[model samples]
Target: MTRPTLQGHLDGWSQGDDLRRDVASAVLALAAAGIRISELLAAGPLAGALATVRGHHADGDSQKELDVIADDLVREALAAAPVALLGSEEADEAVTLAPAGTLAVAVDPLDGSSNIDSNMSVGTIFSILPFVGADSLLQPGSAQLAAGFLLYGPQTALVLTVGAGTQVFTLDRATGAFLLSEARAFVVPETAEYAINGSNLRHWDGAIRSYVDDCQAGTEGPRGKDFNTRWVASMVADVYRILVRGGVYLYPGDARGGYAQGRLRLVYEANPIAFLMEQAQGAATDGSRPILDLIPTHLHQRVPLVFGSRAEVERIARYHGGASAMPERSPLFGRRGLLRA
Candidate 1:
């Protein structure tokens, strides 16, 4: 139960090691900020069980608890010297970090807003790009220098990478500093257990249906290995599980009108997850191409998503198979159509 030494980690980084130092510094500072914010929420006004409570939506006059908390956390992160460009999910416009700062930070101050009101395990996500000034905020995902998430559930924790390896740290309640709990490097299995929203099954496109049906098939389907499915409305929660355990998550283009491009935001959610996934030897795609490769035409850009274990993701990719016609009914799906077809 020895904690990772924060003092040494901070003091040891040299000027040449900007990425690690900044990541370590951000982890330390952000964990402190999260603790303060969580303490305030737990004691201040979050009455009743966490599952039942709800925070104000962005449309409301008063910003939600996660917004307030995220804003404060951003401020705390900027207070550290290295941060130069600050982009936040709560704010429409990006803020300048300083006259000439070293780090570009894109943050979803409070992700999973709907769950915030319900007291579900909502948290903040941040992506660090090595850029200065306003350009840093505008630059694409390929520019990311680091990315991570902070979970505000049973125990507060941080998982981040400065381009070396993904490392996970738990916040110490007593000290307000992070101690490495999991030495993490995740390589998703070739064939993945997948995550997708099942309710929209009626609206899924041929490609998506083909993919899901195969997963549900277990060994019976073309995939030799059995499959499992999980769906969490929270992106952080889903990504967190995938980072530790091998699996795939999909929010691909479906037949549904509103959810055609899928749900999660591009700059704040997809980009960050994509950056971290590649760092950990995982992959992220919007079904057509790598998530990180897609240029954002708008800030709140939405896109189809499929990510996690490499093999599983690749298999999903292969399902789309660039064929004009999707496999609507599998040869193995003969129980229903053998008589009809």
Candidate 2:
């Protein structure tokens, strides 16, 4: 039997719900970007046509040539759809279109662009929310009616959540459509894997440092288990691996300049992924609090993001909460104990 296309699934699930047309339009825009991105990647980054667009995005991230192209493609597509305000990382302010529409869309046209030169996976992220004038666009992740991301990896996939369950769709090159591949996707509540940039270990707060030390301790530590570490640097790829198996990812706030507020943008990156995590029986947080509960004061607000299996995420939270309670001296502190504590 043939698998259902994204539109088919949306049509069936959102038949009577509000923002049906708006959601459909947004998905189409994402699908279009996925196709274009595949073509660009295949053509090779060194190609002059895919050269960097001049200057930087509003968030101060350097813009790649493909970033500019993909941004325009999505903007035009959504502008012609039911999306009222288009907020993007590339734009300084929201662009109002379809003034009468009931939904707003915020996008990261090209996430993890820094990995593009190395042929690492990157993706597009989007959040759909109610259009209550321009103000609604700044609302928290809880206000999102739908959120999804498209991964342009070895196999392009779109993982999404519509306040129900999370689902995944893979691009069928033959049909040029995103076909449902995983229904009601869920993450393992516990696993022996974790993802983080270990090179920045010294800059991490006490809670994060303590947690990493435990993982590094292997089966001889307090938790008494070995953990395999993985860090793809690309949020999409890292999170996708967690979705496929089970693991926790941390990009926490550090004391570094411009990073105290956290790095990932709340609107486009954290919010969408947080929504997916919860819908998939997982969790997401900024170490101290739930990610979806965060209210964005600006369109480009950033927040530290930690997400994955429930038990593992909770453990990370424990470390954050009990950082002060951490013993100044421990049996396992500053030394590796062969015997489990």
Candidate 3:
């Protein structure tokens, strides 16, 4: 049987609606840009120091050469689509694409750019929402009409959802098309793996530290089951792995100066990921709250992101709420043991 192409999928969904058609156009544009980006990344160093630090965002995140290039590529592609506002991580302000268009697009043009030099997996995450004048791009994740990500890895793939079940499509280099790979992707509710930056254990709050500690304890500890740990330092890669297999990914806020609110952007990163996770039968949260329900106060605002297997995510929330079945460490040691005050 012939596999359905991305265009075919979008065409079937957009049929007679103008807004849906425009949204489909924007998604197609993103897929086209992803193809170009995958090719550029395949060239590695031949692409001329794509990982070189060109500058820094206003928030101090280093802006790499590839980040700017990917942003330009995505913007140029969206220019032909009916996109009114473009909110990109590389841009300090949202760009007005088509003043009269009805769709607002938020994107992390080049996610995981730090992995560029290492030939690690990276991706582009996008959220499509209805244009509602000045506050169109600031709407909460729950308002998203569609969200997805293009993974440029061993095989370039597109994982998407349009208020329907999440689906996966892989690029067929020979045909130059994205063909259906997984028609209805679902996240397994339970998991025996997790991803997080373990080095920050010292700075994490009691909840995060407690969760990690329990996972580390294995069958001999509270969970009563051995668990594996995986951290690619790339959100897209880690989340993709969890979506395919079963696991949990956490980037929680800690006591650090700049990282008190977490590092991922709420609009382009966490929101889109949360939307996809929920669509795939998974869950996402900012520790104790649902990620989709959180309202964005600004475009570049950061928030703690924890997503993956539903049960694991909820358990993490319970840990945060101090309602876990695990025994407390003791008040003498403070909230997180004898680590600090």
Would you give me the overall lDDT of model 2? 0.84
- TM-score for each predicted model, relative to the true structure: 0.84, 0.94, 0.95
TM-score of candidate 2 to 2 decimals: 0.94
What are the per-model numbers of colliding residue pairs? 7, 1, 0
What is the C-alpha local distance difference test score of each model?
0.69, 0.84, 0.91
Worst 10 residues of 1 by lDDT: 332-341
How would you encode candidate 2's per-residue C-alpha lDDT over 43-162 as one tens digit per residue? 675555564656786556788777887788788778767887889888888889788988889999888887777778888899999898868778989999899888988898999888
Model 3: per-residue Cα lDDT over 40-157, one tens digit each: 9999999899999999998789999999999999999999999999999998889899999999999999999999999999999999999999789899999998899999999999
lDDT value, residue 46 of candidate 3: 94
Error of 1 at 188 (Å): 3.3
* lDDT by residue (tens digit), candidate 1, 1-341: 67665445445543467566766566566666767656655553454232333344343423565576568766765677577667776776676656566777777876765666545676788887776545665567887777788887777777776666777777777776677777657866664467888888888876777677656666655554577777778777888888878788888776665667876778878888888888889998888588888877756667888888876676667667666435546465542211110
Better of 1 and 3 by TM-score: 3
The residue pairs that clash in candidate 3, if any, are none
> Number of clashing pairs, model 2?
1
